[model samples]
Target chain A: MNEKVAKLYQERLNRYMTALDCGKPDKVPVSFGIGDWIVKHTENNFQEIFYDWEKSIKAVDDILPEFDVDVFGGGPTLWWPPMWDAIGSKLYKFPGMGLDENSTFQFVEEEYMKAEDYDAFIANPTEWIATTYLPRISTEFENPSSLRGISALIRSSVAFAEYNNYMGASWGKWTVEHGVVGQFTGMTKAPFDTLGDALRSMKGILLDLRRRPEKVAAACEVIVPHNINYALSGAGADTRFPCFAPLHRGSYPFLNPYQWENYYWPSFKAVIEGLWAKGKRTYFYAEGDWTPYLEKIAELPDKSIVFDIDLTDAKKAKEILGGRFCLIGGMPTTLLTYGTPEKVKEQVKRSIDELAGDGGFILGAGGVVMGDAKKENIMAMLEAAREYGTY
Target chain B: MSEKEKKFVPEPGTCTPWKVKMEELGGIPGNEEIVKKDWERLDETAYNFLWFWVHR
Candidate 1:
């Protein structure tokens, strides 16, 4: 490690530790991670790069160097096709919508489970992820030889961190130098969101929430710990901080507060407590309105972090959670995508004004970068943070 | 008073339809009685009035 970067890392880590407890640090920390929206902005032809890791990393490398974000985050595992692939699903692309625009790989071949087969499906998920799903990825990416070659190429590539440990080392150094604290692990979605993607059919999960409440709760209980375990396993003890990106998606507005309390809250509590036990402080990226559950979340270990709450007003969030946990994010991604640079800067300034008071605040977009977000707008957010994020 | 001019008065101490639906679904377990008490505080007119007021 560069001596300067090492010093910076220690300094920022100390500051973050102090700030986590509601104490003011020497300076406010700023960081950014890779999100799908920013990826789209960097690539002219994202679809082509989506399947090709080399191309995708190239796109990321172009942006990260310029952005100088405090923390670096890895992209989603493209090891398999779209998530549905695990369940014998495939995706078809529609041009112009970007990577997320792809349609599900239809379950036309055969139903993996009968309605009665739900029990069998729950008993073992590894069978699905390994035999059923990984085979498809092996078929698509066919070159273990080619992958090895690409891995070597990435060693030389600026965006090589997807494959090499250098990115982590460099980011660790950047955090110290910039006086920014680094969150070691990527974000975890809420258990319900994971269920929608990995465990049940999206429609099946939503219907199950209404029709079979006990089953939904049971399934959530069974699955949430695994998600927490998965996150912790990736984040070794060396990195004390654990973070998750829990996108709310359809599950947010669709479920009433009653369902949220029974199904979602318990699962969430289990994960948070589980991570806390492992000596990891969780930065939960709550992507939707969490106002109804604000009190429930406030019960988490003090000094945990919550990011990007959608519908909950930040002032109210601060009132509810300011003392208990550090609050990060609330800047609307829409303002970055559709609004002018000036608008983006103004919103960032507003976020700093509202949430960055005292301590326990970081700034970021409310959600992942969308495909439409202009490059200039993203830069404007960074610029605004630099100019106004002072204590 | 005209319909628009009439002051919208909500039933005091009532639960909204969402709360009612939640109860019917067995969503709120231990707090059912408390929810019911809060629900019973309002008449139908006041209930609807406050329902829109709190939710909207």
Candidate 2:
């Protein structure tokens, strides 16, 4: 890094680190991502941005100079479509392939892992995932012994490695050029989410809770270690930043208090505790209302998580988790989509007043800002964060 | 594979443990540390690849 870039990087990193530790800094650190929303502003459509790494990075490069934030969340797209294509994976329907080019990708949730496979999965999770889950999910890998299946495996593995390398290089370039600090190092999921979201589908898991509750709990128990390992491995064991865990199913009304306490929170909390033991913190990206579970979530190790507030009551979160843990997210994502720029600024001021008063709070959109989110509203939020976000 | 070997479950974050591989190789005449290090790295990659499918 150049001298100028290094200085900027340190300034941003220190600000971010301070806020993460629940300490007051010179200013409230701002986190922003070039979500799919950026595609609408760019000359290129969703496909090019999702498929081409250069185009994805370029999309961010164009915006980074203007987006003066402490942390750079990420680029326009999450995955390279070609990698999904290579595996013949039925996980998602990418733009231009299954959906219109202008539209964002959609996850194709299914009971990829059947009910009968529970015993096999619980018996040996990794082996079952390799031998059974891969073949079931990837059409090309249906017959792993076959030449086509083996080839698909090779191609997908190569693509996975390449994608990781490209992302690292892209982040490096962004840091050198714009002096951006990334929000999180690695990614993981709650163990129940690992089962429900991908393996069982929401419907399937709900049924299992009624009929095969023990199996569900057992499977999740088996997953706790793997989740910790995956987070560490994916992050290259970096403890400097939290591992991103986009929590689902654990949110309110998804599971009742009884079911959540029995099946969900145990394994999920175990994963968090496990990561914390390894000197890692979890970016608890609570997507929906977690108002009901705030007290239960507080049971986690102090500073072991940076709790995100979306539909969760902000005051309750601050009253409960504030000072002990860093609180992020204040501007509701829907406001960015429909509200005017002035309204966004109003929300920003209110958020800073309510949440950032003490410290341990970062200003950002509450959740993933969709493609329809207005640029004016986003720019307003970024501008207003600086305008009001001071110690 | 033998009956006992068939029942062996690999540890988490590993597809095949180096001990298992070492058993298969009987013993390494050369630098065992070098071979084990490279083997574990590849093993880790394989483990990540397996978990990658479900993680999505």
Top-TM-score structure, candidate number: 2
What is the Cα-based lDDT of residue B44 in candidate 2? Answer: 94
Of the candidates shown, which would achieve the greatest DockQ relative to the real structure? Answer: 2
lDDT of 1: 0.55
lDDT by residue (tens digit), candidate 1, A35-151:
555544554454444545555556665565477444444442232232122122232332233234332111222222234545533554433332343333233322324665334
> Residue A274 of candidate 2: its Cα lDDT?
96
lDDT digits (tens) for residues A245-343 of candidate 2: 998999989998999999999999999999999999999999999999999999998999999899999999999999999999999999999999999
Stretches > 4 Å off in candidate 2: B1-6
Question: What is the TM-score of each candidate's chain B when compared with the real chain B?
Answer: 0.29, 0.82
Worst 10 residues of 1 chain A by lDDT: A103-112
- Ten residues in a row with the worst lDDT in model 2 chain B? B1-10
Clashes in model 2: which pairs? none
How well is each residue in B1-56 modelled by candidate 2, as lDDT tens digits? Answer: 56436356888889999989788778989999989998999899999989988987
